[model samples]
Target chain A: EAGVAQSPRYKIIEKRQSVAFWCNPISGHATLYWYQQILGQGPKLLIQFQNNGVVDDSQLPKDRFSAERLKGVDSTLKIQPAKLEDSAVYLCASRRTSGSSYNEQFFGPGTRLTVL
Target chain B: GQQVMQIPQYQHVQEGEDFTTYCNSSTTLSNIQWYKQRPGGHPVFLIQLVKSGEVKKQKRLTFQFGEAKKNSSLHITATQTTDVGTYFCAGARGWGKLQFGAGTQVVVTP
Candidate 1:
């Protein structure tokens, strides 16, 4: 089976500019997630999607961040008017919804976003 | 707000030495999951423990969930260079959302 895939392995943008990260989950997986991993810190959940509907996004910055998972197979996370502090890795992960292996998540290589 | 903390923020040991990292939570947890992330790599799931006082092992790695369900530990025996990375313990207060510890970074020197 193929793993979760992410695009544009690396990105660089200036402050106040807009940036978007994309994620393609493993086939047959029903749950997808977006996380932000700052240097020296563990990945923090930014949003979670079960099928097409959002499950949790309490930590998401509504004013500057938005995400969507149209068709429920792929997802995109956008950060507009970015800030210097947003210069961290954006990780995408997916997991099975049924059967015995439900909670183990498979992660993508992640997109390294450097906000100048 | 809930928090998960990990200790021995960092550890450096020679090959063949044993290493252990602990994770603690302020409140009872429904489950705990472990992940290992190599430098410049994304986190990969190692294992998950849901029952209290459960002990599971994978090769040289041992994982234990405390009886209180608020603490956990990961112990690596006779560490190898392949063990270099950050080990994170994430606790779930409910379902879906996970609170991850800061992680314990391990450096193995030969």
Candidate 2:
């Protein structure tokens, strides 16, 4: 069984540029999450998807950040006109749903983005 | 807004010493989870506590959820080099969303 997969382990861009990160959760997992982890800080949940429908995205910056988990398996997070504050690691995670609850999430290696 | 806070942003201990990190939440949490992230690595789940006043142990690690369900603690006995990492506590309110603490970075001196 493979773990969560994320594309382009690292990326570099300048301010106002655009960048996208991709993630593939573990198979059979029904819940996927995208989190941002800044240096010296814990991960902050940006968006969550249950199957193909979004469950939560209140913390996501709608003006610049957007994410979609189409087909309920792979997800893409896009940052248009990236800012310097966007320099961080973007992590993707997935969890199995049981009855009405979700289990612990397994995370991907994450894409380290550096905005110059 | 729900906020989770961890005490002692950083910790340094000798190899044979014990270490502990405390987490507190502004609001009652439905559950609390612990994760460990090594330097330059992603977070890995260590354990989760769902019941009030719950205490769970794994090998040399012990996790406790407060009776009030708003606080938790992680203790490591006789710490070793392998225990080096940032320990984070996440509090979940209902489902899907998790509020994470800033984390406590542990450094063990050989």
**Second chain only: TM-score per model?**
0.98, 0.99
Best by DockQ: 2
Give the runs in model 2 whose Cα sits over 4 Å from its true position. Answer: A99-101
| TM-score result, candidate 1 | 0.98
lDDT of 1 by residue, A1-116 (tens): 99999998999999999999999999999899999999999889999999999999999999999999999999999999899999999999998888786878899999999998
Candidate 1's displacement at residue A47, Å, is 0.5
Supply every candidate's count of residue pairs whose N, Cα or C atoms clash at under 3 angstroms: 0, 0
Compared with the true structure, what per-residue lDDT tens digits does model 1 show for residues B1-110?
A: 78999998999989999989999999999989999999989999999999999999999999999999999999999999999999999998765578889999999999
Q: Native-vs-model 2 lDDT?
A: 0.94
**Regions of candidate 1 where Cα sits further than 4 Å from its true position:** none
- Candidate 2 residue pairs in backbone clash: none
Per-residue lDDT for A49-116 in model 2, tens only? 99999999999999999999889999999999899999999999999987443658899999999999
For residue B10, model 2's alpha carbon misses the true position, in angstroms, by 0.3
Per-prediction interface RMSD? 0.9, 0.8
Question: How does model 2 score by TM-score?
Answer: 0.98
